[model samples]
Target: MKLTTSALTPDRWSGEVLALGVFAGDDVPSGLSWPRGADAPLRDAVARLLAHGSFSGARDELVAGPGLPGRCERLVLFGLGRAQQVTPHTARRAGAAVARTLTSGPNRRVAVALPSWRVPGPDGGGPGGPGLDLVEHLAEGLSLAVHCGRWNVLPDRFRADYGSDLPQEPESVELLGAADTGRMLSRAEAFTHAVVLARELVAAPANLITPQRLAEEAVGLATPGSRLSVEVWDEAECRKQRLTGFCAAAAGGADPARLIRLHYRPAAPVGPPVAVIGLGLTYDDRGVLRSGGAVQGAKKFMAGAGAVLGAATALAAVGGRSEVQLLIPAVAKAAGPGALRVGDLVTTASGATVELNHEDAHGRLMLADALHLAARLGAHRTVGVSALGLPVAAALGPKAAGLWSTDDGLAADLTAAGYQAGELLWRLPLVDEYDDELLAPFANLRAAGPPSGDGATAAAFLRRFAPPGAWAHLEITEPAWSPRIDGYYNAGATGYGTGTLARWLCTR
Candidate 1:
């Protein structure tokens, strides 16, 4: 949908209907007073009347009554209890509630007088006053509510029977404030587009999203003026470079091996650039090397690769940023004559040696080369976003992701932004204690090893490839795909980090 804002004027701005936001106890500002227009449609106040309406605020309705204004068919009064506790998230819910409620009726447009937020800086007003850019915040809220449904997948029968009956179709928002409504809407649109792209990229079948396909996808990101350079290295190049660590890990996959790299440059050169590395294991059948034959088990490994592709799409869509170099080690883990086995040693691009500890722990091995490549590319702060393990989900639950980063500031920023975007992460320590688990007598790092709830071990393995003092960000596996029905997100790749990375770049 579209969103725009206008001055709270009654003269040139009188419309058929206008929706205003009010806190539980705040007075209606007189600036929005109307002068009884000739063909005014109605005036409405949306209020949270249900006792526990906060959680399911949108599930409530717009109660039309007699206590209204001239030609005022309805009033929408939203609840903001203990106003001091209201945050951006609250604003989002309030916006979603209003939008969802309005869409059910004949209202085609809405003018929201966003509730003012406390300003932390002098850019606008004062603290606890009409502060934080409500326009942007509201737009983000609307975008989330609208696009959250696209990732959701329901039983075909259930959807075919009742999908059209659902009321939560996407909503378009219009800003009624002085802030740059056009730009805010455009950014929101881009964010939504990025989310859609990530979801689609992840939702693709594993066979369709193989290593070569991933490289082709990266090349597609190198459009004119995008400032991105893309390249793909085949198995031959990997073999010569002794990427045994990565190749050994990919030995069981049926797809051809590929190392996909993307380079992004900003118009105005900044300080040392940041690099994002992802584990692009297109498909992992757990290898016939192991006896278990589960199609879903493959998704566990594919999720990591999907995370990388999603991150790339988001980075590409959010174009204006500092220089970035991304390396994705794309390969499938399939059993074959050439597939490396356990106890084998491999050397990384950084010249570090690793032992094939376990064939399934392939994400870390591929990241070895990616991390080395990032360091060689002069990455000041390196961040790797991956679906590393299920232990992360066990630890952080479905809502929040587990994060391990070397840079405290970056970690804090990422965690805070994740919370804001609703797809959040909790800061995890890369304990120096676990550093020895990655070591092997002969290899730089080993592939086969013990499995523990400590998903950060993957990040610990990747640290071997990082240059000293380089910050690293690792997202232990948080199943981006939901096996069951979620309110807005269906049973597919949720595009979990797309918003997080996009917000990081925008604010950075």
Candidate 2:
């Protein structure tokens, strides 16, 4: 949808739908300003709607009505809850609610008058000073929600007649009384495009999105004259580089393994390049012996790769001085004659020998090689994103990802970026006590640790390969894919880390 800013007040705005965001309690929010003697009819309509005592202005609550509004066909009043409790996430949810309510109708235009609340402080106590703009977050939510509505319209192999009757989203959206609308909308569009690309990559079937296909998509992101450059390493090149761990993990797959690298360099450099590595298991099938419904979700094994590539796409469009390197080790794990068996010893690029005890634990192997390569490439800081362990998902649930970092400053920066991007992150300790769980009798490390505190142990294992400067690990499983449409998330891949990574890169 096209997004634009309007100088017109609510009374002068004419559209198919005019959405007004109201805060809790009787008083109107201070963010909504009016010119002298203007917006009286709109104010009266809001006051009358509130006076009826039917709407309490609770979060996500909606009350719509017709008539008594100038030139507008419909009026939508969405609740923003308490003023003090509002944040960028609040605006995002409010925007999603408005889009979901009005998109199914014949309305082709919408005007939103939502308050641009301040972000939380460093301590997350309350609204700190002005940092990120709420209008950008609102646009992100609206665009994402509208794009999600059309996700069902994609061609499906199993159901040829699927999503034939789905309604289209509005053609244009105007942000009333918004500042810097063009720049904010441009950034929002970049983020939306990246996130939608990530979702599509994760939602595709394994047969269609193999390692080669993923490499092709990465190459496609680097258009001529762009700041991004793409490179891919084939099986021979990977072996030459001592990427034995990745090669072992992708041993038996029909598709060849690929090491995809994307580099984004600005016109002028600022600091050392930050490296971001993502796990690229296109399809993970535990092993030949494993069976059940668990493998059905194997298609999402590459969610981390999708997120990093998406971030690369966004960063390429939104120019930044910080040089960024994105790495994805695209490989597939399946039941085949060349598959690594239990008790097999695999040597990683870091010269660490690992005892492969579990077939499903191969992601850590690929990540280990990637992390070592990043450090070898002289990156000042490195961040690895993956759905590596279930213990993290069990601890944080679906709303937040687990963060483990060796550098406190990097951790703080990531937390702030995640907050600004509307993605929640909970810091988990990288306890040294769990290091014993990864110890092997004959090898330097064991593939799988004990079930208890496995998340911490897994982080500890990856920490061995972390760069000496600064490094972080983001375990994003539950937050990357959802089973239902909750808030701004659709029923599939949520593209969770793309926004956070993009925000972090640009801000840095």
Candidate 3:
């Protein structure tokens, strides 16, 4: 969107709705040191709402206020609790809250004002407020807030402006703070576009975004002028390479499996060669079980794929120098006689026999093959993304992802990246003991097992496929999407791991 800056004023502003930021320690000063309390309109407004007392900003706390008769067409006053604690993430969250609250209303245009955050300097230099970085975060939030649906253009969502069902949201966002915000606007727009691309991938429906179509997308991304080179291993190629684990998971589906790889070779590759493998399950029906409840978000089974793609696109856009191998083992889990059943045995490319005890756990199976492929290709560092365990979501809550890593350096690198991207990650253990749970009596490893440390068990299974100390597994169950809006997210198919991986790679 067209992003700019504006200073909050009681008169002569552009927008149907205006959002003013109120800080927790904010108050209308009686001592007229600033330009208020004597004859200012802002002071009058504050005096009118003195009894409400809810506008005191505490972190993660918000309070709404009504617009004045002449001041605001519609105004929302949000909290920026304890100025000292405010970060880019919390600021983005505030922006998200405004977007969620406004989209439901008839208001077509909205603007969010950023409150000056207290950045205390060392050696008694006094607390300084926000600058360009703050504006970037605000714009990032507005961009993410408007993201709600998939790749399709639905005619049913027509707006009155176009006299059609589809109308772009938050037509404009003026990050009302500083005057010269040109650099901030540029940074925010680029960041927002990358994140939204990932969101669209996650939101795409399973029927439309099948394995074949996903492969086509990777091919499409590899344009003549682009630095990325795309390759697809069709069913035959997968068989030739002995990717049996991936094939076993795709046996029942009418749509065949694809081992899609996007290699990004910069002119001068820098840092360690990194490989990111994502689970691209078009529709996860879970073997022969046909219960409706079983496949609720099976379409979103491709969340990890979206994240890796998003990261790749972002890195490309920024001209990053990392030699990255992006891989997605795409498949659809269909329930039928031909599908992989319990007690079936398959051998992977690494010469490890896999026992299919729990036939529905295709994420670990496909990721196993992809990780082995990355290692075989000589990836110095490897990262895998998937929403493998529902129990991880339960154990870790729906706020942060559960991370299991074989290396401290990789874990720390990814964790710092998540922080930079405003995504949260909690490091969970890939316990040595959990490795025993995956061992199969009849084969090298059982495909699936019980619920005790199931998240770790899944990671442990994939760890076998990758070289030690070079791999990190992110069980990204929480950041996928929920039914309603949460912090920095509007609803439906959040582009979670996209930012983390992208930021991590770029910074490295």
Candidate 4:
């Protein structure tokens, strides 16, 4: 999309919608007033709201102008919710509200009055300090909201029955101020491009995004200047290596599976390498092979795999000269007689055995193998993306992802990035007491007990295989699968960790 910055005069721009950012009290910019035609209607609305003396200005509203002279069909005014407390998150909501409203109208062009924000700490001053940083974040959220999957074709009957009209593609966006619109657009475009690739990769027909397809996707990333490699192990090869845990999980599904090892070596390696493992279950239909409703807990099942692709996408976008390895154990944890049973015992790639405490816990098994592979590849830090469960949702709510790690330093970096990106993450401890229950007679890892909180217990399970001196990260599952729509993200896959991983890669 084309993005331009100029001394924006609302009347000069004729689009279906125009968005304004309003702050509490007198914080709203006086120089940012709309055109005379746009002003009358807004003034009337403001007067009415003013009538309600209790209105302290913390909410925004969209208004239709009944075809005013130079005003667009609608104007979206966003409330900064107390200028003193106005944050990057408020900017995100403002941007998203603008995009969503514009999408509803036929107007292909839109302009936004960028939200004002406090600059970085001492590194950057407050008000006068890099005020446009919020604009960058707003643009990012808006772009992510408009992203659609090219490959999620509904079944014929479902499409005919429930398909709703979606918004038209926006042709251009206009931002006020002499700020660096070019830089903001560049970053937004790059992020959207990665999201498009990720959505397409995840939305690929289950068959096309299978173990083999995952291998191809990784190989494709390694074409010319990029250093990428894919090591594929078929069923026979997996058996030879005794990746019984992974195999047992895959055995339940009808599709053949493979353990995909993807390596990305930077142009010139810097510090210790970082490794990421993604759970690649192309299609997550739980009832694939099971009998009377055995596969009930597969809701949002494909999210773990999708998060993995997102990690790779983030790595590819922030393509710096740093070494990173990504591993994905692509499989569908379908239940069939051949599948690993709840009480079955299996061995991990680390030579540590694990009893199949829960078949649905298969994501951890693949991660275990991938982590082992990462250590073998000599990675100094590691992280895995998987959807844990609703229990963690109970802890952090839908907007936040649980961040469990062994290293406080890495967690600190990621948590800071999460706040900057308007993504929520809370660091939970990896307690040794939780790992006691996982010990099995023949297995190196086992479910200690019913998960206290999915995020904590799942991270605990992963810690069983974590190598010393390595940092391991677990993404709370709900936020990743959250269907909540903010300004730009419509109610499907949020692509949550892309920004976190990107920031990590870019800054670190």
Best by lDDT: 2
How do the residues 348-431 of candidate 1 rate in per-residue lDDT, one tens digit apiece? 667777676665566777877777777777888877777655366666777677777777887887776665555767877788
Question: What tens-digit string does per-residue lDDT give for candidate 2 at 1-508?
Answer: 7888886666777878888877667354332232223466766666655555567567888877662544777778888776666666777888888877764455687888755433342334544544446678888888887777454322443323325332257889898878556888889888888888788788787888889989998999899767999999998999998898888887887688899999999989799989999898888776213325554367667889988988888898887787888999998777687888888999988899999876576788899999998988889989999876456766788789999999999999999889878889899998788888888999998977887777888899899888779999998877888887877777778888888888888777
Query: Comparing 3 and 4 by TM-score, which wins?
Result: 3
TM-scores, all candidates, are 0.78, 0.91, 0.85, 0.83
Record all residue pairs in model 3 with backbone atoms less than 3 Å apart, i.e. clashing: 24-57, 57-81, 58-81, 157-165, 158-164, 158-165, 158-166
Candidate 1, residue 36: how far the Cα is off, in Å: 15
The parts of candidate 2 lying over 4 Å away from their true place are 26-53, 67-70, 115-128, 149-167, 287-296
Alpha carbon lDDT at 475, candidate 1: 70
What is the descending TM-score order?
A: 2, 3, 4, 1
How well is each residue in 218-240 modelled by candidate 4, as lDDT tens digits?
66666565456667888788878
Query: Residue-wise lDDT of candidate 3 within 60-166, one digit each (tens)?
Result: 55544454455455566566555555667877877766665564444555666544523431223343533225677766776676554434222223222422222
lDDT of 1 at 220: 80
Global lDDT scores for all candidate models: 0.59, 0.79, 0.70, 0.61
Task: Report, for all candidates in order, the number of backbone clashes.
Answer: 44, 0, 7, 6
Choose 1 or 2, whichever is better by lDDT.
2
Model 2 TM-score? Answer: 0.91
